[model samples]
Target: MGAEYGQEGLVSTSCDIYSFGIMMMEVFTSKKPTDEMFTSDLSLSHWVSKALVNGVTQAMDSRLIRKDEENFFAEVNCVSSIFELALNCTAESPENRINIKDALAFLQKIRLEFLVKLSEN
Candidate 1:
């Protein structure tokens, strides 16, 4: 599956995106990507999914040093958008996964937005 579906089929980019998404979630939560805490129907992806359904604020890692409302809102929006893209990249069906170029563009946009927001401060 890894070879045919992930490598030869040109799904490597999508698989990497899935992994990157998982990593981003871990970074935001300060938890291992596949820790036991996320077991029992509470996988990291599931938690993120629920949070996205409700609101991005609910998904933020409490450890992150949020400065103020402006920064907080900006961060929330950035993370939320990233998580949404990640979710799409990690869908069960290969056909549902997003291409790598799109993922890179999304991440770049997020980074640029953060930079702009920081500069405005």
Candidate 2:
């Protein structure tokens, strides 16, 4: 459930977007909202938000670590954009979150950019 949906039982596209954002964060960060590192003040979203200021590497799953990979920089940039998108999707307010259509479009762009970068390597 999204923040609003979880708190107010308001079912809508926002809730589904929130769910998608959460899944993105979990999949990319390899950290669950209920992870031991997260507390009442710091959730997965919060963690990612903070970690991003430092660098995408901090928020990424260890398995994705590849500092020497041919497309490392592109991967970092793409994942960073994705983290930001997830954060937008998981906004505390439903009204502040992005729609699924926008999210999909953004992802398609990221995918294209990533593919181009990969090919360059």
Candidate 3:
């Protein structure tokens, strides 16, 4: 459940989007929101957000970093786009959050760009 869900006690599509964002972050960083390292001030979201300021490479899983060295720049761009989408999905205000359709379109665009980059290599 997201903060909005707890704060408002409302069930809506935005709630599901928030959960999806959390799952995407977990998949990328291999860190869960409930991890022992996460506290009230230092959460998984905060950690990733800080790392993203530096580069997506800093936020990504070590395994991905090792495997995608050939396409590092392209991969980082794609991952950064994905993280931005996740943040939008998890926005505190439901009205400000992106819907599933737009999220999917953004993801597809990222994928297409990645493929084009791969072909160029």
Which candidate number would show the highest TM-score if scored against the true structure? 2
Per-residue lDDT tens digits of candidate 3, residues 1-121?
Answer: 6787798799999899988888899998888888898998897777778777976777788787665479878888788888888888888788888999999998899899989998998
| lDDT, ranked from best to worst | 2, 3, 1
Number of backbone-clashing residue pairs for each candidate, in the order shown:
0, 0, 0
Least accurate stretch of 10 residues (summed lDDT) in model 2?
Answer: 1-10
**Candidate 1 or 2, higher TM-score?**
2
RMSD of 2: 1.1
**lDDT of model 2, residue 75:** 90
Number of residue pairs clashing in candidate 3, backbone atoms closer than 3 angstroms, sequence gap of 3 or more or interchain: 0
Clashing pairs for model 3 are none
Question: Which tens-of-lDDT digit does each residue in 26-110 have in candidate 2?
Answer: 9998888889988888899988998789877998997885898777899998999899999989998899999999999999999
TM-score, cand. 2 vs. native: 0.94
lDDT of 3: 0.84
Runs off by more than 4 Å, candidate 1: 1-11, 67-70, 118-121
- Give the Å error, residue 65, model 1: 3.7
Model 1: lDDT to the true structure: 0.73
Provide TM-scores for the models. 0.73, 0.94, 0.91
* Error in Å for residue 11 of model 2: 1.2
Ranking by TM-score: 2, 3, 1
